[model samples]
Target: MAQAATITIGSKVRVLRVRDRIPADLVEALKADPTGTVTGFRTVDGQGIGLEVDLGAGKGAWFFDDEVTLA
Candidate 1:
């Protein structure tokens, strides 16, 4: 399988859009301002591809490669 585009740690990323795969509760908050910093990688289905972004002010969210972009 081809690898998805992933943001590097400490890089800034913007939430382009949230997918149905994301939990409903997190969708709105994640898209509120549409910006965050890549803090780390998260595991999903045994793959360390999920991107962890910190939105600052103690707020943060994790999104897959397709949900965010370099900002």
Candidate 2:
């Protein structure tokens, strides 16, 4: 995991398009239903950070919380 950074709502985050895992779909789900609980995040070269979001109630998912803006 790279150095953690601060992220806030309304930020433009990237989508980790993992095959059959969690792609843009998951990202949309998060936007639709943001539980406010950050599941996972990691930084990558050029690609920015990847985020795994657990939407709670077994409705978990993953995406790239890349362009997240800190409040």
* lDDT of residue 41 for candidate 1: 83
By summed lDDT, the worst window of 10 consecutive residues in model 2 runs over 8-17
lDDT of 1 by residue, 1-71 (tens): 13334457988888887665766545666657778889888877785477889887677778778777889
Give the top-scoring candidate (lDDT): 1
lDDT of 2 by residue, 1-71 (tens): 23235543333333333434446765576567555455566555676665555555566554455322222
| Deviation from native of the Cα of residue 62 in model 2, angstroms | 1.5
Model 2 has an lDDT value of 0.48
Backbone clashes, candidate 2: 1
Winning model by TM-score: 1
TM-score of 2: 0.41
TM-score of 1: 0.71
Error of 2 at 38 (Å): 0.9
List residue ranges in candidate 2 displaced over 4 A.
Answer: 1-4, 8-32, 43-46, 66-71
Cα displacement (Å) at residue 24, model 1: 8.1
